[model samples]
Target: MPASLSGQLVVAISSRALFDFEAENEVFEAEDDHAYMALQQQRLDEPALPGVAFSLVKKLLAFNNGGPGSGQRVEVVVLSRNDPISGMRVFRSAAHYGLGIERGVFTRGAAPWRYLRPLSAQLFLSTNEADVRSALAAGVAAARVMPLSRQASAEHPGELRIAFDGDAVLFSDEAEQVYQRDGLAAFREHESERARQPLPAGPFKPVLEALQRLQHEPGMRIRTALVTARSAPAHERAIRTLMDWRIEVDEAMFLGGLAKGEFLREFEPDFFFDDQAGHVESAAAHVPAGQVAAGIAAG
Candidate 1:
């Protein structure tokens, strides 16, 4: 058979999401690709500092160091908007950081979401909003990485920790839409009544499902959490939904509208995903965070 990424947890990440190219990103935004390419060549030997998703990427790549999985095989591909020449620096930076990323697609300025289908990427992380939206529309679990977000600490080098929000992230925005259009009381009441019904799948559902497979890989250490603003009566529905899907998280935090930053600090996740930009910004202060940009709040 042809070389394939089958039966693996495949992730597609952008050059900017994997490395700290904030300065170069600005240059690309203000000038043209030529200027950006020139700068990359000028600093060709300088390896980039790690970006927001670096820790998550590094940990996921660790699964491949052994390379055997019923589903633990992990492949991380660089799906970037940078030119082919600039891609050299991306590879060099990954090499410098010891990330074994061998596959990539450099599209210069065009949308890179077009390649997600071929890769069958379970997750797509990028700094570009348009590309992320396109990936979500195409049914790929995608997130707009917060480039300026803080990187995770090296306190736990042996395990990979990941977190996600509930409504509009792991679950559909139906309950969230009810809360937005109505009020908290109504949302709780709506959820309580339909507690047994499964909420529709959100963008990150596939990503979580893929992680579940990777979690069972021999000798792999991965932790996942469901941190949401939900609490009590409304929270029952969330739990039931996960049970309905037969998926379980290592931890679940129903903060009931409490600020999530400090709580996330305590959890010390390598990365966290939230659909609300406010929540993403809050969690970014304590842990590496990304915005899903899905549902009503994202608008």
Candidate 2:
């Protein structure tokens, strides 16, 4: 039988998203590709530092260590735009950090999101917005990783914690637009009236489902939280939607417009995902953060 990623949770991440390449990226932006390639070649032996999603990827990969006959339950592939030569450093870096990432697709400068389908990736994370948007358009769960976001706490080495916003992320932004246009009262009334109706799925729904599946596997230690700004009546719809999907998150925080940073700081998630730039900015200050640039708020 052919070696396959079937029955495995696959994640496709760009080199920049997986490691700190800001300085190298600066050269790529200011100079030409040749200069950037030269820099990467110069430091080929030096392993790059971990970036925002590093902890999340590391913890998720730990699920594969169920021993001999257990088989691999997770796969992390480097889906980068760097040339094959530059990709050498990426693989080296992963090895240096003890990450067992062995698969990759180096596209030089071409879009790498095209490979997500073949990989059966439930998640695609990159520092490049264009790549993320392309992956989303292709029906893959994608998020633009906040490269400078705060690193996750090292306190919980054995557990993986992830948090996500509700509207525009786990669910469609239909209700979010109403809140943005009208006042709070109108938004609450609208949500109350539509409480029975489940919100439409958002781009992150597929990834959430994949995580839900992973959580059920023996020896997998994963915790998920829904941290949304909706309160009271509005919260009912979001809860109902999850109930309707038969998905259960470990925790749910309906902040009712409270700043999410402090709450997330205490939660200490390996990564947090939100659609609004403001929320991402706040969470990035306290935890590793990624932005889902989809829906009306993203516009």
Candidate 3:
């Protein structure tokens, strides 16, 4: 196991925040086998997420399959308690698609996972408020019990820092496309021209908002970073945008084509997410990274 995963407590989250699982009626309908099966068939082609959330899920599946770091040192738990109606279906679909989540129970109740006592990364799928709350509470317990953060001056278990790309993760990608299509010079001119304009909603907006609530918790178990390719003149949009979104991102880095791998190395992020392969390639080397495929046209 790598030092990053060693003695670390990490959990990846998936909910209405990252994925719109209830978009189709068939997804929730019990009678439409064909529609449901067709939906199931589409899981492989599901778009990648913009934060480490997706990678965290994949890593969780890997851990479930006995990949590595499967002892008392780490623990993996999936909490689909958020969308009580859809959590089980999503878990079942993942298992049906061949991601071995052995001995996992799908229930409408909130239950502490005694089975995940040992593991580096703990992946959780939370849909219910109680479930998500439970997962965070468990995370708090892990920070107190984990060995990794024992010597660190910080009072938390594993720190559990998460990194995100701003444009897509925090605010809508409506303006991002303009920047990409028009190039940096034009993008900056446009953003500087419209810095105070209201920002559109992004996929993680709600999740970020939830994090803000958690941020105020007596002892927060998470920290976030917003790393974007946008530079100075275009920066306030992100700052003000986060303000408008009301989510607190602890560290905000606005790099103009600067390599993220180095920053990720120093930040020691538990996970990082970017919409571009270029960024993911670099960051993945230093942190547990994943690509967000939303808003990206199919290649």
Candidate number with greatest lDDT? 2
Measured against the true structure, the TM-scores of the candidates, in listed sequence, are 0.96, 0.96, 0.51
Q: Least accurate stretch of 10 residues (summed lDDT) in model 1? A: 63-72
Q: Worst 10-residue stretch by lDDT in candidate 3?
A: 142-151
Taking all chains together, the TM-score of candidate 3 against the true structure is 0.51
True lDDT of residue 204, candidate 2: 88
Q: Candidate 3: where is the Cα deviation over 4 Å?
A: 1-158, 218-220, 297-299
The lDDT, on a scale of 0 to 1, for candidate 2 is 0.92
How accurate locally, in lDDT, is each candidate?
0.90, 0.92, 0.51
Please give, for residues 67-102, the per-residue lDDT of candidate 2 as tens digits: 677778889999999999899999999999999999
Q: What's the true lDDT of residue 27 in model 3? A: 58
Pairs that collide, model 2: none
What are the per-model C-alpha RMSD values against the true structure? 1.6, 1.3, 14.5
Candidate 1 off by > 4 Å = 67-72
Clashing pairs in 1: none
Worst 10-residue lDDT window for candidate 2 reads 212-221
